[model samples]
Target: MTVSRTRRAWIAGLMLALAGGLTPARADEPVTVFAAASLKNALDEASAAWTQETAKTTRISYAGSNALAKQIEAGAPADLFVSADLAWMDYAEKNGTIRSETRVNLLRNAIVLVAPKGSTQKVALEPGVDLAKALAGGRLAMGNVEAVPAGKYGKAALEKLGAWDGVRTQVAQAENVRAALLLVARGEAPLGIVYATDAASEPGVEVVATFPEGSHPPIVYPAALTKESRNADAAAFLTYLRSPAARPFFERQGFGVIGTEKRS
Candidate 1:
């Protein structure tokens, strides 16, 4: 009787262990996402949705697209990377750091000139207005072209529009587009160049003019599976981001949802 009871207890313990092992371990796994700083609000919403839908959690790190791209090149343990421009994505793809087939252009945005609401510096937007004359009121604000994708686009547009040479000296550079927007919003700078989405993000900033389409190369956002991702859930979330449900969300946040019709 004693032997039989001991054997039964062992069997019950084994069954419990087997049940625990059969349960999904994704419950504790973290999906790490590296994305552009401008995508903070939109990606946060998407991350919440992914977690709720899959019972898995995501932790995101946001920064300038160039900076994040360099980090990935140096072997950052990121499961996913979302870049504000395709340059970084292309770099990673060519270097075998990201799954090239997983690359997708997820969104688009445009550069714009912004000023603080009710600013004494009257920024005029008439056709053929001289950019140097317009930016002469106070210091200009812009993102650092070395690290920021928006800044790179803005600089390219200024260069293409023949505005960079005159206004380059007046510019005060920020680390990212949102930072540039903040400077203009605080009235610390008379003019700033940033993404239309970044201008829209700040309540106190107003768009003065948009960089003409084709003034610079298209601003495309690309996302890809990173080399360090361990969880299939991260891959799954990337799939969700490409779905119809995410399209409306990106559009409402000022992204021109790419891969969707109507170019909205």
Candidate 2:
């Protein structure tokens, strides 16, 4: 028999209560969100604005989309999930970890080549650009290309530009895009591939060039409520994220707000 939404929520709460031998949290408790690391600055500001406006508290955890999706799969008590790409959000939906009806494309970003501040590395991201030679024997910092959304997008852009093969052996993979950005910011790596917003947030790094949108899969950020979310305020927070008030914060950080529209 098909269960109703109310029944399913009750069952989920019961299961969690039974598992922990404790009562479910009150409806007004803080909303917890698992978000992509690249969204730190804007999201934090937006969330703070929400709190200031409504007096509702939020707890946001930032990490790689792959890591956040896996955490949701493992039953982390997160009310919302914001991913850097559609793939991991699709994975969460396929795994039954997110509410399919609540999912929406939220924001967009572009990948860029970044170098430490004061470095005179001028790069044109055209086909067959000698990215390896620009590295000067230094490594290119990127998130784990196998999983992290930023890394996957960076790799795709590099491959499309015919530069991946030349520098594939010189990549220094990090746990997340922010970590890779740090590698460049700290001068541990001579160059890095990160979102344009990331390069803007860190004064220590300067953007060399932005990858063509056609060079890689569109960098779309999708947000959704987790299947296990029971906080009464969680849905409101998700809605607030798409509201007009939140648009400025994201735009100020170089993100394109997609509103309720889905990317084609």
After superposition, the stretches of candidate 2 with alpha carbons farther than 4 Å from their true spots are 1-24
- Across 78-144, the per-residue lDDT of candidate 2 in tens digits comes to 9999999999999999999999999999999999999999999999999989998999999999999
CA error at residue 180 for candidate 1, angstroms: 1.1
* All candidates: TM-score: 0.84, 0.91
Query: What is each predicted model's overall lDDT from 0 to 1?
Result: 0.80, 0.95
What would the TM-score be for candidate 2 when compared with the true structure? 0.91
Off by over 4 Å in 1: 1-26, 120-128, 260-264
- Distance (Å) between predicted and true CA of 248, model 1? 2.1
lDDT of 1 at 56: 85
Pick the lDDT winner: 2
**1-264 per-residue lDDT for model 1 (tens digits):** 256988999788778866856323255788889999888878888778777877788889998888888898898878899999888888888888898767788888888898888765554443344777876657779889666888888878878777678778887988878888889988899789888877777888888878888788898898988865667777888888888867766777798877632222
